[model samples]
Target: MDDGVRNTREWSPPPPASPSLVVRSPRQTVSRLRTRRTHRDWDPSLGRPSFAARDHGPKPSEVYGFVGSITTVIATAVYLAWAYTPEPCLRSLGITYVPSKYWALAVPSFVIVAVALSMVIYIGLNFLATPPPTSFSTMFDENSRERMAFSPAMEEERPIEPILDIGVVQINNLMFGDT
Candidate 1:
């Protein structure tokens, strides 16, 4: 793979030569730029434009993202103004179409509380579903897949097997000096 990459890098095709147009004045510069031919625009082999050449504009997703960002900023400003502005001032300015600002705080607070409660419920469910430490499922569950074991004498010849689970006794002995 390395040799193939090195060979290709060393013998890659040279880029097409850029056209040189002598510009008489600043006025000609703009015209020359409009007519300028890049390697992408011209093909040296056929002396014409390449069939693959395309002037792709921004993708639909890119346009959507730009519009979405602008919309979000505008909406945020509107929400902040509606939520924070004094009721007396808004009435004085003849602005009565806006909904009550209570929703602005209530909606966000409700979302936060819902998310926190969901996490707590999920944790409780997991605890309820867990098997006890003394259960046989701890050593060999229905879902557990066993790896093939190799003899110690033939370990070097055989490929290394994935790690197998050890008992808590072994773990405690290794970490706590057999206490």
Candidate 2:
């Protein structure tokens, strides 16, 4: 805290370039990156800028998420202002050239309807792909197996059948005395 230096822009004799950054070959360093950085970054000690200075901007990946979140917040604020602001008040605020208020309501309404419709479509697709309880495939398909005799080698081959639909009469008898 008491270095007497003002800030991060510590204007001192630049530190020696690390072995990794020192890419000198045949007199001049490979200056493919010199064009990217401004002349302000030129170090008198090194004679020219290196690729390290060109990397001052934020990484592409980091910018996407940060910008997306900020954009969403700004868009939401603008949408709310557009929806609730009174026309005369807006006009007084110098916002004269605007679309109809009906669009503000209609856009959100359409978006909500679209989201609801997508959910319905998802459910409909699931229903379309599934066989109903009463479908013939539910009772028996070509893959259905008949009950086989118990193997004497092992009485507990299986305690009960693996996959078979129960009879409606058996279900009714269990639930109703009249059955």
Candidate 3:
């Protein structure tokens, strides 16, 4: 190589990126656009995940306990109504409860049973219903416990603040002369 001629081999620049070259396919481009749109559309006000959306998985113990409680309550009510027919008691008091021969003691007993059963069902449902756990142990156990420990009283107390707008009322009165 001649000393006067500059060495071209060590001084080569990288080729410029072509504007026409497709780095990403059409499907990928569409998917990225859709994802951006979805993120933009989400409302910031909805703070937490819903109960149905949480990934705790199905708890068979809870389901079975609820069903069993309901069944037991119904069976107890039915037994009580059958054992306490008013006809015998009324006869002991020297008064006929139902003079009509058509209306048997069993009719009243069935009605009482149905009413008692309904009450039992309502009670069982209320007692057995468990509110879903607020946080998943794997994702947020430590953070949630720290938050809870910081505000122990807040758990028992109402979290919502009262909306007292005395300033708003004064402004309204100034605008439209107090009626």
lDDT of 3 by residue, 1-179 (tens): 45333222232433646757548789987996776532222223555544643468669999999999999999878556445556677587676544544344676778999999999999999766744455344234333322222366666774654443334445678999796
After superposition, the stretches of candidate 3 with alpha carbons farther than 4 Å from their true spots are 1-53, 56-58, 87-179
Candidate 1: where is the Cα deviation over 4 Å? 1-51, 143-179
Candidate 3 whole-model C-alpha lDDT, 0 to 1: 0.59
lDDT of 1: 0.73
Residue-wise C-alpha lDDT for candidate 1, range 1-179, written one tens digit per residue: 45422222223444545566533688776886777644444434545443555566899999999999999999999889889998888889998777877898998899999999999999999988999888988677555545576678986688866666666676689999857
| Per-prediction TM-score to the true structure, in the order listed | 0.55, 0.44, 0.20
Clashing pairs for predicted structure model 1, backbone only: none
Please give the CA lDDT of all the candidate structures: 0.73, 0.73, 0.59
Question: Which whole-number lDDT from 0 to 100 does residue 54 have in model 1?
Answer: 53
Top-TM-score structure, candidate number: 1
* lDDT comparison, 2 vs 3, better candidate: 2
Q: Top model by lDDT, which number?
A: 1
Measured with C-alpha atoms, the lDDT of residue 39 in candidate 3 is 22
Model 2 CA deviation exceeding 4 Å by range? 1-58, 139-179
